[model samples]
Target: MGSPDPLEWDFSCPDWEQRLRDQRSLLPDLPLDEVEASRAVSIFDRLRLPDVPGQPAFADAAGDWARDMVRAIFGSLVDGERMVPELFELVPKKNAKTTNGAAIMVVALLMNLRPRAEFVLVGPTQEIADLAFQQASGIIDADPDGYLQKRFQVQEHVKTIVDRTNNARLKVKTFDLKVATGAKPAGVLIDELHLMAGMPHAARVIGQLRGGMIANPEAFLIFITTQSDEPPAGAFKAELDYARAVRDGRIPQGRVLPMLYEFPEAMQIAEEKPWRDPACWPMVLPNLGRSITVDRLKKEFRAAREKGEAEERRWASQHLNIEIGLALHSDRWIGADLWPRAVDVTLSYAELIARSEVIVAGIDGGGLDDLMGLGLIGRCRETKNWLGWGHAWAQPEVFDKRKEIAARLQDFADEGDLTVCEDPTEDIRGLADIIEELNTLGLLPAENAVGLDPQGVGALIDELSGRGIAEAQMIGIAQGFRLSSAVWGLERKLKDGTFVHAPQALMNWCVGNAKTEQRGNAVLITKQTAGKAKIDPLIAMFNAVSLMGRNPVAEGDNNGGLDRYLERLSA
Candidate 1:
């Protein structure tokens, strides 16, 4: 089969309204205990809105959609099956997600009925955890008759609300895996889960939270968050993809119900960019006019646009609930816009070698502090697309030196896109062997195809020469403005959908990190201008693209000269 569709990269729930309607239709066939659902809604509705002026009851503050959603989540039941064990809710910011989360936990605590049942509310940071705790505490304090106070012991110091009746307790904590390791939670509310996307151990922590759910069928785990300003990756991307898949009816037996507030696929892919129109903003902002106003958003957007392109992209991502990749800077590599569309995970290294008539390799690296990057670019004979694969290696010492990006590095390591070498020399030898192996297989260019940064490649050149790769094959590529044509050529391939790459997180991160600097008539992408981010792999790709552009291979020519060279080598 061909590669998976590039559109799958966008995990936005475009058909959310139809998904909700389908869910509502299933309620009748679900054997739902309306009485239990009604009771849960009633308990939740009794809680007061702490943010409101006079602390109005939740029922009064909640909109119709909120009340119905809460009912479906807590009250729905089946005879011998769990209605929904997980809930993924995505909404824009300023929608009172925290307040609603607090109320949901309160209702869960009231309805537990199980002795010593534990309900946990987790936040990405301590401040957010404390904010949730405060919201719940405020609701408890606002009860005029001391109903909540009399029924539960509010311990602000410990961040717990203990139910006097069943000894059940509700607690709030940050995303510390150590804290969640052994706890048997009856329900978990993960607030702002998008923030924990890059937390290397997020999957492990979530597994621990759901570990006890198999025993407690009534257990529910709810992930509530605003869309992240950066591209989704790691645990967040996994969960969001699964949620979207389940919502779209692709996974018939999934136990997760997704309620995502965003633009539909048609609007998202529209030629006129309807999503940018203010008239369509309210379609995604369900809590508009209540928590946030259109006028406020318009004012903020106006100011953001004036600030710069990156700022405006961030504003749209956060305010309009758009899921997008990073907005590095105004003069970012033109390829940045097309990279997302070039992802094709089905293009494995073996598949590339098997299909390509000839391949060109690029090597870019420095000392232990920098990443050692290798890129392979080839013309596939079958589809005729320019397929590419990239790998990067870093020393363990980088983790300590670049502490700010430690988690991100760990994430890339976990995804197998990055190699953490104990000895920097091992990276040089390993990359050399990889290129040598591909060259021995008769897939690589016969000569003058392997591009390397002119400087800092003495060891690599020596290694490749030792492996029978001639010095003539190792061409030195110039850096800076000299490589502007290669950069522009790669951007053209990406935009034309002729450039394809195997899904590699480190490569994507490197591509996103690249920012261009205009040097006279030529534009240059440099690590110096990209701040602390690493763009070594992308630089390597640019070097390889320059060599590929020089080759005399015609597009869609199955009997190209490279194919004859490969055939003669095999003979």
Candidate 2:
């Protein structure tokens, strides 16, 4: 490979190359003599731009940053003695992130320290991983010189291995429990982590690769994704927490560096001229001007804003990194008129308590690897408006505290609100114990039920019936996925200025963190794609709807009404 003629382009002037050099210097101010500046310059020189049909060309700063990051990653990996895994998690959306990360993976495979290194590119699904593979192959096809094609060989039906003559043998695999069992991955790139749902399974698979990475401590495990859910927990949340710790100096220094690009939690877009909100694109997106045009984003996100759901609007804002009122991904479902400003609410919990004659409580249980949420919804008989109400949360660790849980249940019941609690735990023994304790305390309301997650707790269902708690409902099922009566009810209530929530941090989090997934006949509701999509709210919403005896007529309701459905838990 020969260097391009200096006269051909003006790198001598204040162009991308100079910008790359400046960014490279932003490193911990390490001594220039020791750093591989020449090698860094070389990698930047080879950085290629793929053909994106309509988008503006990548910004120079973005190109420079990508080049600098790749160089730094390589430099860190090559050092045999000083090897630490570095994480590159960014929030930049589709255009810039995917294209850039794909380029980095291709280059890493093409030019690596190990000859025929076994590299794995993993995603939640095969199709997603294939997209990356196609990009890499396209780069080879688009290579001006026949370098990549000549170097790499494709054995017709067999594996398409990278050229061993050079140094890298790249292999790609999607995250599968069965397939990933015994494999040793030299380098692994995880994409769209926001879509991952099951943590324990993912953790086990990732753990298996640890022993294999010993040879090359520089062996990378790169996670690249856009922000989907709020953290303080979950895999992504844990990652965000650690990254923040590193930035804030909470955790003693280590090399698992994190780069987060998100709008601050405080910024809010006004009802009028919401598109003008800058909270959509914070410091995280450097390719704002070039790759992701504001005009294009405005057009794309405009429909989602019409969903008429505050929760959905918050989701569009957080995930798309844009303000509400623009189009949303699920345009028709999310109505824009929902979500009255906070100022509209005049009554506090105290006033609501004084006036509320009837109250119904909904407790969404967070079992192992899930979040438990308690929402106290009160109904005004005259107005038929479910008053904006109180709520609480018990972290996953506290699920075992039956006494405390029962007491809290009793407390809500005494307030004439504890009508139903959804216990979506696989451990029916534990949930039964909580119900038994509540019953013993006489805290159980005259008409109340518990929603059990039927999918995983079938065996325990029979046992619950034998114990006379046959009314425990099975949750995390049916239409409540994302478009349930409960969700729409909440949406309608929010829109019409009726539903009231106490503004608890976790509940707001649960609301903001939720996302929609389309299933064949029914839509599955999920909260934050941690390792895989979690149906915390599916169970929660079922409990909320089933207990209040307030099932709205949505598409997915079965023949059994809410009470009849709960009665069949044991049957």
Candidate 3:
């Protein structure tokens, strides 16, 4: 069927009018206050749109979707207290997200009954914060009747607007702890919340922001954001996932009202990718015919596609609200496109051991500031397929040095795929312990069971020697073009449907980050080419692949030895 009109229905949602109906009279969810909503609308009606063609007031410029968002934000109030604590709206870019957010905050400021209270607009960066200030100040400045101008004080340098009558201030700030620290606010508008997801202390900052609201019964939080340019991680992922759950009615509602703009789940999973169709573009674009048009977006999308896969992915993520999946970029590894197809999510450590006849390991990159990656490749007992798993370890210095990927690394840590160690002594010991466990089960080959890069592996060698791993059990794998066979072999195995890996975010990220090239007669993926994207774990996987190709047998013929020794170790 075709999309519903924005004036009558929520076009993006597959459920359509169900959520709005539920919010009206559902128990634990009180009815939306039309009086308070009208009050909020009056505030919006006063705010003029300066840059638009007609210079219409917000009441005229806002579509039903915008009005619905405004009503849900304000109509949750009964008397002077807020019924809903938070409202989350996710929309695509070029929809005036910044301007809409500014208008909402201004209405919030005007509706505040608390004296000397604070209304804050928080942006993830300084530039975003400045833009918010300009839009909000412009709204007041554009008032020809001196209505808002006479009641509020706009301080350009400080980026603050103070209500002259009530002594309340609306402050615009870049993401800072001080915004959430020690201060209680009547209302807060978190602009572009997705951008804050990558901050090192995203959870803590959000917690603090919410924590401050405990004191004010009338407090409200409005989060307006666009789809992230990269894969969502950290706080962004958590909130976005929660919003989806709430919007889908999988989670109970009333406390949080989510207005998510994106393709319906069914259409999103369609075989042909319905979101890619120009006809389906309007499904997610609620601002259609106003802030943006299908033709303009189609033109931009065509340009992005012509540039390369990477550019296209970024554009689709921002515009169509499509979550970025695996890289699958042309310049990426040979197996990049095939990696997702070869996932066996049930492949855990115990599962690997239970299914494998023999297992080989690869270790790479043990620098203090670098991530030390370990890959385990196992030959299946019956299927004869290869099962893969990976783990990574890093020190505190990694977080400080690689701040850009720190949030993602922290996410990996939370999933138990990566460990952050403080003591260097305990770090190598952890890897050694895993190697020792596999050897104890007699699952490892008698010779050359473990493959490691020879460079910067002196410490690992010492630890392994202490655990009684002889030199032959741990062979040094050559790097760069020399290991091309394993590189090509892994791709062939994945494509031939003989090799599959545990569905792991760490491996997915590393695989996506990998860049490959043909060097003379050999295909190679080097750390130098991968740069800061960190493909150490993938290199380690290749090292394991190199040894697995040898087809060596376990010490005890891989018999009843595994269950016996592993149970005893647990005891």
Candidate 4:
């Protein structure tokens, strides 16, 4: 790949309203079977809702929003066949996604022309699968008339619903490779696809399911999910991104139609934050008058805000369809909460050096399976504000050891925040070269400018020492509670919008992974507290903050002495 762009684009859809209209438009002109579509909607409407107040049928309890979504998903058929083989529906929580999946699968069974066909209902776990099966069975049991009972049989022990006459069976199973090994299902419904995204076999399982669906030409697969609580990753991210592109008209819809319940980019990123306004909550909450209520959601949102920033974010992501970009862990460093706001993508490594009176650095060591992080903090020559840049290096083993985050690591690599080195010594040499170049520049302070963790500083020190960088330039930043001042100081800078960093996804991930603990009145952030999630880059930044917090000044020629050290870097 070529050099990554130093300028980060804050993309907001200016034609969001038009795009939204196109996405949710009913395909009325398709070669659809009007009778079958009407019949399917009728069947869906007759399905009983036992849990809802008054135990009304779906027609009585469901709002127009749900009825439309159900119609768009299940009833649209071309030449008596399903129009789209696959549909992705990303809705907020409490929209009855699972129940809707069940209802549509029942409609598919009733209207299906194929005999002895298979239908699949998949969930991320057995517990989730069981709950979906319960909903399916409950809908069946709620029918006061004997028609549905005589027409179909629901076996609770096996979590199977069978159509008696057609011998078509719908089997509920957790998402697993073995689930789709041999079956050719007439229709498949996947509930909470976001949860299954993290599964190692999610892609393979989905591939197998798609293959199974291909065996039945008229079959359809529906994926119903809510936004992930955390930043999107893995198979979920892939599909979500693709679906969004299609919804935005960046790509042809082809066989997949995405019905995503999300705020327009303008509302989501607007300075006013209209998404957070209680009056605008109904825009995303399709079930506002039915299963969901505006006042109830407002009350819950207020309670979540009182809990903590993390809880508030979680509540927003779940109920308001607000995308989560920050740390949701209650113990996450406070700096992480404001990290997005402090993003100055225009701040590059060269820009940081060019605009700074002095620049200090930090280094954090990691094992073969982890990243070596370098963070630079430059105090702006004019504004006196600290501008930060971060980079991480990792051995190839990181992919093997942390396979779950390998995709995200590759994303960081693409974004130029990380480098995957062929050799461990190569990473050290890279760090030493950047430091040597910094020292040659006038911005790096002559003494106590580089703060490093002492645990594994030998290799870097040896390389830098050979280059004539004095040992006095490197100071060991105390870990744990002792570095509390730097930790707190960085938070203050970020909160007041002074500490600016090159908006890197790597930094965001590290910030989200970071967890802070109060130790004897000091806030301590440690890798040990972050569990397996890598926070080396963030730790290194705090280390740099510790050194910069001392207000060191460079003695070298500030303008012309050193060559561009960062032009070699991708960013």
Candidate 5:
């Protein structure tokens, strides 16, 4: 169904009708209350706070979605019974997105009639997470009840809050896998969601929320953020993807309310005078004249353009709503608008391997403390798609068990597949237990095997070489197998069914914890910080790079460890 035309709805929707009813009730049926009307008018007239107005006078005070969002929150509290369970508001950055998010969070915390309302604020990182904390605290301080300190008990980190009344709690924290595992939250608000795509840990944490959400039937999940200038991933991308589907009417229900403030891809930055795109002023920024200044935008735009910072330019135009990289970054590898769902192919892994003529395996190793990943690929004879044969990962800490890992390697070798292990480490005595097991299984006979060390795994190389393993190198394939390349490749394959993996939880963890950097060319794997107080992405990359190696395969065949299956098919 197409979205109702702006004119047809008559604003009879429950939320709209309720707002009108509220407005009517707020005003008396008597002679005009100049004082009340004037106060409302001042809200629109006075842009800044303090001297700023209290409430919006007209319904058009903000963009439709923005207004609708405010109404949704207001209705959820005061209107009570009629509130929707979920509110997805996607607006580009600098469009007062954060300010609006902060406002809703404040309302949820203060107005709920419950003795203590629970609220959770999540950010992609600690600093990003603190934005909501800072904004909410400021709003409460300005309230009359001394609410900042007296009403809500703020704790060591902004993540925790206690209600002075019922000892109810409100909290804020960065998206970490462990923090939210079994959390029973009443309301969840995510900020700077675009950054979530960079880490897999966020996915695990969010998954826990989805399952645990049933406890509070009336709980709300609020996904609010701007566009991602990088390869879209994580919750932000998920929200935007769903919103676009809603806007296009691809989905029957309009669950998500998207209030995007993005400029056209063809916009030009060097159009003589700045603010060249007139269409940009209103669509991209709600605080254009209020919190953000036109001069500030112009100066930043010129600097980014002159410096040829294409990423910065795209970020400014899309996230900040300023026109910058109109000409440069427009040639993106894949446009954000080109989201296509994969066509379901129902062939099982064994069946796929049975029909393939070539097979190849890609091994991504984790650090001594990281995760080691292995992927098997086989060419599907029918669809020609690169069928995902299998995917596996072992914790490096566990792989420290030489004998156990060796047994696992022996299994791969016994299956008669071309098994490729990145340079074995001292974790298990040069993976001796594994090599011996592989030799016993008679996969490559230990004569043709090679160890790869793209970085300087000199000790590993020496040990493997001493053990009589081949000293072959794979610089070309290894270079192409870096984090950025592997992620992009895996994403494409997964989306296209060119790569398939058996259902495994750890595989999903690696996929979700992997975060892409602003470079738009590399990815960062996150790790727990020294204090274990927080997690960082550098640790994952360290482990991912450790898995690089070269493997000898038959010419023109991408045997990512599927040769055994190909031999079966040939037989």
Candidate 6:
């Protein structure tokens, strides 16, 4: 129940080898029942490899380090009870994770003491579920003495293996919240957790699966996954963070064991970049010679680097398990790298409005085939930091024409960050309505606060004025080199951590798509340079920041000054 003992790591660590040794030494030394652990390993070892030429022993095919890891996991105990109720194993691709997971499930089924118990293996897709089931079924059929055949009945059609003596069964299933609704599982295995991170129902399904464990004290849950190429988000990131906390002894283990096969913190941040070095590859690769070879990795890495920067970064993320920062394009805006660090999920629209003395609106009216974006930026009364929120609207016809980005647009629509309106004209009205609502809330300034592109906003200006917004409030923000100061200010705010925004997926995507161009000594982000990608939301942010730089609200008197300004406008 206490925090982990102080770590022996510091930035001054001499080399990666020393940091790695220190990390391995920090693993918790819980009470372990050697007898039970050996028995579990014996069951696992008896399961034959399905794919090998002669169907070699699972122990031999899994390699020594993997076998030992399995032994340590199953054998560990606390007060003579199961010490690890949950286990997380994060490794790179082609590491024999699927086969190893199947073996672990078989061992778990054989070791369960409770009669009529149910064990489940959940995969992100049906194909993956079937693959694991085939591996488990093959293991059961490979028993030479008919020990497993006589003890258990394999039902391939239903993907279940039932122990005849105890009436216990192990089943493979794809992620489904309804299937897990009332099922009580003695043990659960989640495969490719990163694939499910983007699923809207992933959290609910996982909660249901783990919730059934209350009746069984010895129940176990295991997660096996590879790093995602996209940004780490949702449940996968949350679980990974907690596992790391427990691994480092920063938090109590609490029946959880984390085996993370990744670079140490110090080595990961090394000036010489040890993680990128071929010599350090073996440090993170426990199953190096068996599942993967350094020669193949080196060859593949060389080819990937030659292809392009994005390909190289993707290869490193998948093969090396290194989390590269978020950048969609190679020539991305300078602020794109720091965008992830500026996210404050707790900053809601209502909270931002309440805390700020004044709010400015920014609009980017992208063409018929692109998104129309509206953004709000406010300066916090106490902290003086800028808080932002944005949403985009697109006509359904745009998706019909732009088939390439249609799926991505649909995903943003599903997340509530983007809206697909029936008519293109509705987007302008929608944005005008938002401004009127904020103005009624007394957050928006009565004049000179809404900044937008001057060229194509005659209709928009009329709509805003109809909604009680003064004509003087709609200021024209010059495009190209003239707006360089705004771009530079936004970059400075991001780097200084003086800017924060709610996690808006649409905005994140737009920012990632932005590419910069230099005009004389100034920098500019233009849609023409961004190609087919939509950077409307990010452009809207820049427009809002440009207006906010004018400081429409007086200093030192945050609330009363804004109230008096609004009162004089109304009179």
C-alpha local distance difference test of each model: 0.77, 0.47, 0.81, 0.79, 0.45, 0.77
Ranked candidates (lDDT, high to low):
3, 4, 1, 6, 2, 5
RMSD of each: 6.4, 13.3, 5.4, 6.4, 13.0, 8.0
- Candidate 5: Cα lDDT at 87: 57
Backbone clashes in candidate 1 total 1
- Model 1 regions lying over 4 Å from their true place: 1-29, 76-83, 212-217, 269-271, 338-358, 379-388, 394-430, 441-443, 488-506, 518-524, 552-571
Report the C-alpha displacement of residue 264, candidate 1, in angstroms: 3.9
Error of 1 at 39 (Å): 0.9
Worst ten-residue run, lDDT, model 3? Answer: 3-12
- Model 2 poorest 10 in a row by lDDT: 8-17
What TM-score against the true fold does each predicted structure earn? 0.83, 0.56, 0.90, 0.83, 0.48, 0.69
Query: Over the stretch 240-310, how does candidate 3's per-residue lDDT look in tens digits?
Result: 88777766667654356677776665665454666778876766666667788899999999999899867
List model 2 lDDT by residue over 1-571, tens digit each.
1332222211111122233223222233221222554564454355455565432222342445465456556655333422335565655565356566666676666556666577766766777766666655665565566676787764323224576476566555566675366555567777776555324355456556656666665577777777653222234444555565654446544445454444333333455643335343424445556666767656655654565444455555454543332222332234223432422236544444334434433445445544344344445435655554434333434334442233223333333333333453433454455444333323234444444343444555565566655352323334345336555556666676765544333333334334555566554454433223223433454456554554322111222222342354437
Model 6 RMSD to the real structure? 8.0
lDDT leader: 3
Per-residue lDDT, model 3, residue 238, is 80
* Model 6 weakest 10-residue run by lDDT: 4-13
The residue pairs that clash in candidate 6, if any, are 448-473
Q: For candidate 4, list the clashing residue pairs, or say none.
A: none
Cα lDDT of model 4 by residue, 1-571, tens digit? 1332212111223354554444443222233345666777888899988567666888876655555555655555554455566777778898777887777777777878788999999998888898888888888888889788899999878889899998999898988888888978888888898886556667777888888877676788888888988777767777888777766667644456676778876677565677778877766766667788888888898899899778987888888778777655877788876788888969887788778878899999678988899999999978899999999998989888887777677767867888899865888988888888788876788899889998878878888899868878988988888889988999999988778998787888899999988888898889899988899989999999999988798978776643454444544
Please give the distance, in angstroms, between residue 240's alpha carbon in candidate 5 and its true position after superposition.
2.4
Model 2 ranges with Cα > 4 A deviation: 1-34, 50-62, 77-84, 154-161, 198-200, 229-241, 268-282, 303-571
How many clashes in each structure? 1, 32, 0, 0, 26, 1
lDDT of 1 by residue, 1-571 (tens): 1332323222234446664434322121233457887898888778888767988887777654566557766665454234667888887888788888988899888877679999999989999999999998888988877899899999989999999999999989989767577788888999998888767678778888888666676788999888887777657777887887876778755757777776665665454656777877876676667778899898998999898767877787778877765545677887887787788869867666667877888888876778888888988877778999988888977776775566677777877878889775889888988887766666666566689999978888888889988776789999989999999999999999899998877787888789888889999888787878788888899889988887734222334534554576589
Indicate whether candidate 3 or candidate 5 has the larger TM-score: 3
